[model samples]
Target: MPTALPHLPTSRLLLRALQMDQAEVLYRLANGPKIADNTANIPSPYTLQTAQDFITGIAEKYRAGEVLNLGMHVQATGELIGMVSLRLNARHHAGHLGGWVAAHARNQGYAAEAASAVMDFGFATLGLQRVGSQCFGRNKASARVMQKIGLHYEGCLREAFFKNGVYEDLLTFASVRSDWERAL
Candidate 1:
């Protein structure tokens, strides 16, 4: 795995490494009920310190070939819109995909576009054999993005995720290297 993070370009977005300067923007975009409720990891009261720590940790993770978390930025306006990530399991040559688009950026296809770019990097650049994603069962938009990216629906894991003091069903989706290649 390479130490340097990648810059993935889509038609309307630039997916790049998060910078320290963008911590505040990340905090603002992520510090909301809508985002926290849907995601497994992000806390509801997301603070600036959390964003800072994440940005700081991502570099080390990248260097260790453990993860890649890219900020989604609009190419035209250079505005930070969201984030996409791939957490690698080198032993299995697979990766777990995770991401979120800001409330203002939802329903615009940004999630699918950015996610596709990262999946491309994972298979083509990092030699990953499989990439998978899971979303809360209620997040229909996220499921759409997974399908749009050519990930086949696997199944639902009932009460697999614990978030916000409740159990939530998780819908899984995935694409192996062969399927991903055929899609391209």
Candidate 2:
């Protein structure tokens, strides 16, 4: 099945597919120490060239239909402040949701708001049976976003995430379509 490109909205944000021109802004967000610590794939010193490479990879991934990576933009300023994604594995018909807001944009409910938009797209439009998220044990902010969006608190997998030369627990959270509907 061909997946549609879904553009979602919140009161002040628009979560749409990533564009090549968004590299510079994304570079700044991904390079932040706090943002890198919360994610497994983004390196610590995310450079402009690294962001360019990321944009290239995302372009390729979009063509392949392996993931739907969206840029979180402020509607008022027309700036790319972060990203939210719905990643699908074609073989299993299962997907994962993830997101990050720039350091300057934290504590304003942007992440949770953008994530809620993606969750609505996943369940209401895409017809996904189950969508979930994971966070590093130390990432309380991300965990809170999950809860704020109504995802259930699933158990942690002890020592499951090996990062920065040490093993850290990973907390898994999920929300089904029913749960999402109830929250609405």
Candidate 3:
């Protein structure tokens, strides 16, 4: 199974797959407490080697039809602002959404714009029945991003995420295919 990922161009950003040359940028921007603390997969003290490894693994994962990881870039400057992903669950026909924006790029709605594109891809291209996302409860901005993209708050998983040192609540939101179609 090929990645089937698309090059999504929005008004301000270009969403595409991770490139090998971006290891340094991914490290410089994503290797911090701000990003690492919130996401489930990104680890703090992120290293060039780790970024390189992830870049190399993208093709294989895409071929396996399990993951579609996209790097969000500024079209005019080509600077990487963030990343977004859709982790597919084949049996369930569902996709789990994840994303982040660089600290400097925050508050400008870049993450939300890219997320909306991914959600559209998950439902229209991947044929996922539902697309779900979550944020650590303390992160109101992330939760708002999910809500802005039309995901309804489902419930919270108490102490579900153990990052830094202690557990934090996880707020889940989801949007179904029918809802997406109806909106469009």
**Candidate that would win on lDDT:** 1
lDDT, candidate 1, residue 176? 99
Pairs of residues clashing in candidate 3:
none
In model 1, which range of ten residues has the least summed lDDT?
Answer: 31-40
Candidate 2, residues 41-141, lDDT tens digits: the string is 77878888888887777756755767778889999988888888878765655568887888888999999999888888777776777789999888999
The estimated TM-scores of all candidates read 0.97, 0.91, 0.96
List clash counts for every candidate, in order. 0, 0, 0
Q: Which is the winner by lDDT between candidate 2 and candidate 3?
A: 3
What's the lDDT for all of these models?
Answer: 0.93, 0.82, 0.89
State the lDDT of candidate 1 residue by residue for 31-103, as single tens digits.
8548888888888699999999999998899888788999999999989999999999999999999999998
Rank order by lDDT, top first? 1, 3, 2
The lDDT of model 2 is 0.82
Measured with C-alpha atoms, the lDDT of residue 149 in candidate 2 is 87
Write model 3 residue lDDT over 1-184, tens digit each, in one string: 3456589999999999888889999988897548988898887788899899988887678678788889999999999988999888989989899989989899999999999998998888878899999899999999999999999999999999888889999999999999899989
